[model samples]
Target: MVKSKSIYSCVECGGRVLKWQGQCPHCHLWNTLVEAVAEKNSTRFNYTNEISRVQNIEKIKIGEEPRYSTGIAELDRVLGGGLVDGGVILLGGDPGIGKSTLLLQALCYSSCDRAVLYVSGEESASQIALRAKRLSLATKKVHLLTEIQLDRIQEVLGKEKPNVAVIDSIQTIYSESLQSAPGSVAQVRECAAQLTRIAKASGICIILVGHVTKEGTLAGPRVLEHMVDTVLYFEGDAQSSFRLIRAIKNRFGAVNELGVFAMTEKGLREVSNPSALFLSHHEEKVPGSCVMVTQEGTRPLLVEVQALVDKSQALNPRRLSVGLENNRLAMLLAVLHRHVGIACFDQDVFVNAVGGVRITEPGADLAVLLAIVSSLKNKPLPIKIITFGEIGLAGEVRPVQRGQERLKEAAKLGFVQAIIPKANKPKHSVFGIEIILVDRLEDAVTAIF
Candidate 1:
């Protein structure tokens, strides 16, 4: 009989310690160590009897992996052309963020031709059925399994041999071998490792839904993300109907890919043209409003940048930003004071990207600065004008990647003029837009004002 012993494991790093401590010694994080049970003599294989073979790198043959479409074009785009055989995808999001709804819709649509299974450890069969019926999805061929035991789930997967399977939230699944509670660090890590091994060995595409921490990162040990083939995050506001899925890691496709969807009474509906969703239309051009183009993976997106400047009565003025980095905003304000002769030291400044969509790329730097200046001066930028470029500390306008693609997208959306870095100016002018090339911050201000 194997003996069980108590061990302390760090939730952030998955490092084990013999005793408990306030801070995890491995990761140096406070209060992340949790108690778990481990069984002695758990190893089933003898390393002394195992033999390994090595082959030449040139002798290995490569072939294209088969992909199964989820029947949603936007999701297909984010997954890098659909789900690959034996690939494991990890999807994380906030509660009620439509993670399960999107997957359910996809499985229903995909059930037309492929064998798909939805294993629910979180929801009951009737709960899932009610959601499907509410969404008016065709679920005749879709298979449902309500189980949480790791061994039983693996047994069902082997017996059913479905091409695709979804474990609706890995946090709820537990293994009898490990005497840890479900959703614990040890349980999550062990269950994910076993499921990934099964997917690879059986050529099954598995999707694991993960819970996010209060900080919006995936919960559980960090190794859980490393074990998966792809990592996707669902982002949006609860008040808003729009949701965005972003790919942070992918082995078969590109990372940072984005898929846009809208939540309706029925279910999640893919937004064919996501650019329109991020742009706000007004009766007239307003001060502190500017349009900019940003590149998300392979697609170019147009988003509006808005700013407001007000007199501050407080000793220290407040600097706030939404949908854009706050630290970058402060740096940009300093640049404006040092280079552009505009100061916001005594004013309260706020900046926001028009939609809930977060902008990470520095391509929106130029547009953000321009919007701030416009707001301070109480002047409106010209209508149908777009701008995008990176700004350096020395006030130089740096070129961004895919400049031509951004310009073309802006033009296609009826933008009449573009203020871009001199290096980003196209070799041949776009048919409908006039390009204003600026080499420095002063040049941009002069051209715009």
Candidate 2:
């Protein structure tokens, strides 16, 4: 008989120690170590007798992996065309962010030709059925399993041999070999490893749902993400109806791909044209508002950037930004003061990206500065004008990636004029649109005002 021993593991890096500590020594993260049981090795010489051989690289066969559509065009786009055979996807989001709803719809639609299984460790079969009925999805061909044990789930997968399967959540599943409770660092790592091995061995496409921490990151050992084939994050405000799914990591496809969806009473519906969702239709041109083009993966997106600057009453002015970086706003304001002679030293600045979408790239810097200057001067930018560029501390306007694509997207969306970086100037002009190239921040300010 093998004996089990207690050990401490770090949730962030999956490093094990003999005792618990306030901080994880391996990852240097504070308060992440949790107690878990270590599996004993009973047979030291139990090795595989099968011999392994190495083959020449040129002789290896190369073929494209087969893919299956999820019935949702947006979802398919994020997954790099469709669900690849033997691929494991990790989907994480806040509570009630429609992660399960999206998978349920896809599984039902895929049930038409492929064998699909829906495993729910958190909810019962009747609850899943209730949600299916609410969404008006046909569930006759979909198989439902409500189990949390690793052994039982593996048993079902082996018996059913499903082409596609979804583990509603990876945190709830616990292994009998580990004495630790479910959701612990050890249990999550073990369960995820087993599921991944099963998927690869049986060619079953498995999607694992994950929980997010308070800081809006996936809650588990960091190794969980590295072990999977793809990692997707579902982001949107609870109050807002619009939701955005972004791929953070993909082994078979492009990263940073985005999928837009709108939540309705029926279910989550894909937004074919996501650019329109981030733009506001005002009766007239408004001050402090500017349109900017951003690239999400291969798709070009047009979003509205808005800013407000007001005189501050206190000694320290507050600088707040939503859907954009706060620190970058301060940097842009300083550049505006140094280069353009526009000072907002005692002004409270608030910047926002229209709609619920967040802009992480620096391409929005120029548009943000323009919006701030427009609000300060109380002058509306010319109607149907768009802008996108990066601003440096030296007041230089830096070019962004795929400038031609951005311009084409803006022109297609009926924008008549674009103020872009001089370096991004295209060889041929886009039809129905005029481009104003600027080399410095002062030139951009002068051209717009």
Per-residue lDDT for 69 in model 1?
A: 93
lDDT of each: 0.92, 0.93
For candidate 2, report its TM-score. Answer: 0.96
lDDT score, candidate 2: 0.93
Largest lDDT belongs to which candidate? 2
Error (Å) of candidate 1 at residue 253 is 0.7
- Please list the residue runs of candidate 1 whose C-alpha ends up more than 4 Å from where it truly belongs after superposition: 1-5, 27-31, 44-52
Q: Count the backbone clashes (under 3 Å) in each candidate.
A: 0, 0
Worst 10 residues of 2 by lDDT: 41-50
Global Cα RMSD, each model:
2.3, 2.3
lDDT of 1 by residue, 161-246 (tens): 99899999999999888777999888899899989988888899999999999999999999999999999999989999999999
